[model samples]
Target chain A: MSDPMAFLLWVKGPMFNWALAIFALGTLARLLEIFLLGRRPNYAEPRGGEWGPGLRTVLTRSVADPGTFQRAPFDVLVGWIWHVGFLIALLLFIPHIELIQALIGLGWPGLPNPVVDAATAVTLVALVATLIHRLRHPVKRHLSTAEDYLIWTVTFLPLITGYLAYHRLIGPYPLALGLHILAAEIFLIVLPFTKLTHIFTAFIARWYNGAIFGRKGVQS
Target chain B: MSEPSIERGLQALRAEIDAPVAAFFSSCVHCGLCAQACPFYLETGDPKYTPVLKLEPLRRVWEREFTLWGRIKAGLGLSPKVTDALLAEWEELLYDSCTMCGRCSLVCPVGNDLQYMIRKAREGMVASGHAPEGLIGAAVRAVQTGSPMGLQWKTLEVQIRHVESSTGLTVPVDVPDVEYLVLLSSMEIINFPEYLEAIARIFDHAGVGWTLSTDCFEATNAGVQIGSKDIAATLVQRIVDAAVKLRVKNVISPECGHAYTAVRWEGPNLIGRPYPFHVYHIIEVLDALRAAGRLRTEGKETDRLSLHDPCNLARKSGVIQEQRNLMDLVAENFVDLEEHGRYQWCCGAGGGVSSNERADALRRAAFKRKKAQIEAVEPERMVTMCATCRTQLEEGLEEFNMDIPVVGLTEMLAEHLVEK
Candidate 1:
């Protein structure tokens, strides 16, 4: 904890491993609980099939439904921006791709460093806007719990720290990188345990919604 | 009935926590976008009306019993428990404020089925004795008598006689192996006998074989609205038994939203078996007859007409386009509400809200959204297929002095039918 170089090494080695282990196992356990609970077989004859509609929903739900865009244009726009930016920065950045390649043996082409940086900057601003909106919007403010704010912080910290580390803006390179990695480790560990689990469960939920509505012959 | 207790409520909640429920709970990030989709929330501007917030008690039970981290927190006395106090607090949110319109389900960013959860949560609420008295009374009458409104077959028989006398067409009774068995809601029987007469004329004109059953004339299921599976099963079984006795190929649910939903969609699941006969909303049958070129129409109404799609018929059971098809045949000057079909705002009297007297004021308040929609369209007459929606529209428009007369789609369609 005292020496910056040694701190970086400890985080990069042991802490990273622990974080990954917890992330994988915790997410697995959460998903297993949902699947194991099992849905009852619907006895009614389906007017339409579930598979096509379910998959369509998985893609279509990414956009706001009709009237939703008109009612909360700000929320819809900002939500799309942050999610798209986050995905670009996470999946298209070189360093993140390298990390994924190292861990899962999956590699893909990464965007330019400047492009990644731009996405990170916009996503950071969107996250801040999201925080403000959550605090100020009556419905969001009322619905939010302490865990919601905590998850927000957990999600925001890693991105901010990573941005700072990439630019080498804080203290020393090793210290900044160490802190960024440490924040990310914390994020990975807390994700499956908090509302952040939506990262995975949202698709499952959308699929179920689509499938049920589809079987009823409704395009939800 | 014995007092419904917290133990039974918790057990009910636990039983209702299936995969979709679990996924919905886990996926909710509390963004509160669902509030924007809700008529009650939009009209009242109450954050408490947020669809996700109404499921708090059920969510607590799911967390405490299902999730690993939740179990640990609960064991350590850190997580919240589902209590009678909480259920009591949510009764209004669950029953009065919500119509189970499924709009919230359609608009949730993460695809959370808030309507489904609310419906499931009502099961727990009823088990805890937190259900509104009006709904409880309706359920009682529904079980003790054949109708939720306590209308006996004698009453429907009177309506049938009137229809027969007026149309000069015989109303079939318990006729075996009919093409369809038509079931009427007490609301339709009491408030709108024209629905029966219209169907009689239409069937006669189309030469469609249909009959009324003496065994289970009532179509509405108070149990489905009350969220009691046992009661729902009993009502559904009666319909199934009647349909079986008559040997009907199909059963046509009258112009009632919940009745169609109960008998067509939820009936099989509630009875734990697939129906031997198929079920259709009256609109669907009429549309099919029209499609088959059997329904010959003579003329269209010149007045401006707009259609109100019942949440159950359009959103819940996918009967949206069928109504629109019927509207096209009967109305020369037809208009649609800005928010129509699957995404339409509820009439605020569905899901037992109309039956629950405690919800009267809230239901009226929620109707403001639909009122605004109707004002925008300014139809000469509002045509809708659901009896509950028709009643609510009539009452709501009258309360607001909108001067709009609500009419049944079937009746209006009958008015345009060609005479042989």
Candidate 2:
């Protein structure tokens, strides 16, 4: 019970439950708070249908428009790289797939180990570049509060720790694995409380934006 | 000062926060892409002009009242409160700089509607008596004298008489059961009486049944520009009453961008009911006439012409292609600015920036983006649908010592109309 393996077991058992509970309940409470606030009915006659544009923006906003790309190429390109890389490593890695299946009874084929490893490396690099850009760019630097830097650290830890655990470079296998799990647990706990809520709320925000402009017959 | 208070400002901000605003505030990741989209930020190189940061007070109110973490922080006196001093500092950001062009909303990576929140933020600013003096004067005059610039009915009567004498067409007033009730802005009545002549000539050429209502001819909504729903509703109600009294099937908003937005987009919502008749921008009416084969033309302008899309018309209300259709009808060599239509750069004087005299230099600075766009095309003459945009473009081009002249789209179309 006093061994490093026991520490790994404890992280996977009791600490994991606490993290999951906070993540689920906190997310639900935040979502409920938004929905309960309620929107007023628009009495203006609509020029177009809402559903089509609302659905379109949810997918289209993933890419920056040409004008936006030209103005801020670094932000747009690096942002895409990080998101794509992180999603691949999170959903396509073999162990993550097994964890998802264990939790939600959903299973899918996993990517090869090398592909996942490369994605992890790319994601780590992008995250660091993102932080440097935040510190350097005048607008980003001015707009960023303490919460932004805190969110970056929390998001960066798990990917780096997972990469180290896979390579067994930091310590023994159980000790590295336990550290990775602990980092992930901290991320999950803070997800609902901070700007990390954008994971789900982005969809809602895009739909509302699309619908409002759509009602005016514009493709926002 | 006695009329507006911090307590009322806080309440107004709390009342303005709804589901979409909640989602927008929650989704923002501070990516700063919105700053790139804003002409003011680009022109001034000021981090304070960033579009998303313009909503700081509103965001603070949203956080302090809505979120659990924010509530906890507030209880501990950790989070900043939305005070009158904070709103006073933000007055220039919200009113003097932003044109409410919605470009920030278009370019946000998280799809945050940053301009929408800024519009809401102005409500609090006004409630706290932190609004610009020029805008406050305009709003007060609009409510008290039925004209933001204090032009009375007799002033419009002089223009009507001049339009009638020149065009040799009867400019009917108070005519009931007409198909369209035409409205005008005081700017057109004072600065550009040619707009009235153009409307009379165009309507007569098409053989359309339209009349001006002496009951209410002014369409510009300074209340809307000042972000006061109560005053906006009062002004809107005057138009509604005029339209109902005339029993017109359609009402036409003049060649003013904010007036079109006020009547066509926010009119019904402000008055709390659907309009009995439809509201159309004059360009929309003109385009409809052309499409129906009613508007015949004789000749086209030979020189190179380019268009400046008004932010409220093209970006805010989707009146993009209609202007182009009208442009094609009258101009043989019409070129477009590099970025026109919904993605066009603002003339930097809409959304009450022009009304706020303190923003004169800032607005001129912001016009550098539009100037650069115009330089790329080198048009002999620039055309626009909104009167406000035309004034700004004219002044900006003159300020830069550019020889190009600005003209109204409707007046340009009227010049080429086929003789009856």
CAPRI-style docking class of model 2 based on DockQ = high
Error of 1 at B413 (Å): 0.8
The residue pairs that clash in candidate 2, if any, are none
Query: What DockQ, on C-alphas, does every prediction get?
Result: 0.87, 0.84
Model 2 misplaced regions, further than 4 Å: none
Q: Per-residue lDDT tens digits of candidate 1, residues B1-420?
A: 667998888888888999999999999999889999988999889899999999999999899889999999899998988878888898999999999999999989888888888878988888888889999999999888988989899988888889888889899999999999999999889899999999999999999999999999999999989898888889889999999999999999999988988888788999888999999989999999999999989788899999899999999999999988888998889999998888998999999999989989889999999999999998989999888999999999999888889999999989989888
A13 Cα displacement, candidate 2 (Å): 1.1
Task: Please give, for residues A84-199, the per-residue lDDT of candidate 2 as tens digits.
Answer: 99899899999999999999999999999999999999999999999999999999999999999999999999999999999988988898999899999999999998999999
Model 2: share of real contacts kept: 0.80
In model 1, pairs of residues that clash are: none
Q: Identify the leading candidate in terms of DockQ.
A: 1
Worst ten in a row by lDDT for model 1 chain B:
B1-10
